[model samples]
Target: MWISRAGWSVLNMLQLIFTLAWTAGLIGVAFVVLLVTRQRRLPLRMAARCWVPGLLWGSGAKLVVRGVDRVDWTRPHVVVANHQSMMDICVLFRAIPVPLQFLLKQELSRLPLVGAYAKAMGMIFVERSSAREATKRMREAAQLVKAGATLCVFPEGTRSHDGEVLPFKSGAFQIALDSGADVVPVAIEGSGKVLSLGGLFRVRPGTITVTIGAPLRTVEIADRQLLAAQARESVVALKREAA
Candidate 1:
């Protein structure tokens, strides 16, 4: 079901239209919910639940999730996963059962409707322009985790080009340490084949598998790097298990 570049344009444009219209409609619902409930980011989790089914249908990617019982969703968690495609975002939202928040880099926060959705969801946007700004955002994220919020982060920082899991970054592990939350490594396969990095227009229908690993407990600062390495290893292992 892979689409040629020329053949993808019309469908891409149509997807764009659906995305914008759907996002706008959801934003309106989020606004009213916010106005009444006054709960920050409740709108985000709500919107995420609504966004997943559409993306899966539009991409023609059937989802197969595994290891749900591996970690307890009742408690807060720092969920880290490998990034291969933008569809991974929606996939995670669908895979995880709880209301989740994300760690958005500065650039994604400025996307027209997407940014507004993140803002409404009360997602933290990290500014990489300077160490100070990034630290500020990380601190906020840590605080959120400490308050029992489930935050999803792609520790590789960005999507991989060839579906390989990239090297892990320290920020997510640090957040786990700072917040005393367990780190959950999740592996996603087949999403890259569905919608690849910079291959937004060339979508194909396929099955995407999500495997969640056991939670890694946060010990102390001395284990930060070790924890990150272990998380990466777990992700790789989970990817194999999923495959």
Candidate 2:
């Protein structure tokens, strides 16, 4: 079950360094974007492109996605998925070829270069510990959707220690309600085993599947609890399918 921990650590460190360089590269791109257009979507396509090799070669993680065709890429949508590890973000970043706005924790905005990159990438950050702050962030996410941006939410709120699906947070569903955005349930498998919560600087070289489920309509759910339940059910079904 254990991959080469020492070798993985070295590779992981290299990824971290590369991410720093990538961040710097993005800053340059952002500057160019400002000079080129009024749109703030400069990091959309490039981020996804840069993310490919960053996870594939940087960590030896290959990706396989299913149900991607089920989605209407031309229209805007919200993506809901499980959070198993930090590697999950990198995997999704690469596999998703579209412009994505991530709903991330506010603390992540504190990271030096990564934070800057996240901002440039149009990530929506929330203060999880504060209900008010979290609400404001959700509203901001809604606005992003209104502006024709696709958002990704890890409804589990945090990474699960065991592979079992945890309770879905209502915030993601709530945003769907406010934004009138379709929810695309995504299931990410094998990432948890690759880089567990046990420690950082860990990786397992193998295929990681990011399966997108059929879009769930927000208006169909009458309540928050129901919305959360449906989101969880979608993720559970996705996991089973991935299994």
Candidate 3:
């Protein structure tokens, strides 16, 4: 939160420019690929490939991942992580090379250009205010996973302002249990410094690590609540290891 005005301005300009350029290029590539193969997974793969430069453009920020092989890409996986900043999504997008569909907020689906792209990417948006609608959306997310689509969910539900992990929602873990997909705990470190939640334009460029943990099969767990707690603990442990 204590960034110099000059540094904040420069960071903001760079983020804006990179976002526009990346979006344009990725969308163009997606259009061409859709025309050729018409395969849904191709666009997601292309998006991941396209995000590498933007992730690197964040000045000094870098990712040091651990337990990368623990991730089983052979089937759908539920990647759960703590929320810290908007940059966390970008970092994970570039770091994890899987065809992922984010369990995003419904409000994000209303954003101008980004929303359109997010929707096209098969991102599941839940209406947080409506419990019934939220449950329905979670069910849809489970169905997506059953369809062999990897789902990424920020269990904290929102970015934490204090750079500390918050309480996680059980929806994601529950979906994994119901869908029989493996739950992968991911810890994203130092992203809060890159873009703090409380700060407006104040940004600090630094390394951000994303450590992936071993996959936990939800079917082995009889209770969903226990599974969620265990998944949360795994992420916290990974964060500590990264620290």
Most TM-score-accurate candidate: 1
lDDT of every model, 2 decimals: 0.84, 0.79, 0.80
| Candidate 2 displacement at residue 157 in angstroms | 1.0
Question: Regarding lDDT, does 1 or 3 come out ahead?
Answer: 1
Model 2 agreement with the true structure over 1-243: per-residue lDDT tens digits:
554757667767877687567667766776577558856565566666764565567656677888888888787788889988887887777766577879999999999777876786678999988989888989999988877888898888889988788999786777888888888888999888767677655556677898888988877875878888888898899999988
Give candidate 3's TM-score.
0.90
Task: Return the clash pairs for model 2, or none.
Answer: none
lDDT of 2 at 99: 78
lDDT of 1 by residue, 50-134 (tens): 7678777777789999999999999999999999888888889889988888998899988987797688776889887788989
Runs off by more than 4 Å, candidate 2? 1-19, 22-31
Can you write out model 3's per-residue Cα lDDT over 132-223, one digit (the tens) per residue?
99999999999999988889999898888887788778777878987888889899999888766664544566888899998878878857
Model 1 residue runs over 4 Å out of place are 1-5, 40-42, 220-222
Error of 2 at 135 (Å): 1.3
State the displacement of the C-alpha of residue 59, model 3, in Å, after optimal TM-score superposition: 3.8
Candidate that scores best on lDDT: 1
Clashing pairs in 3: none
User: Against the correct fold, how does model 1 do in TM-score?
Assistant: 0.92
lDDT of 1 at 128: 76
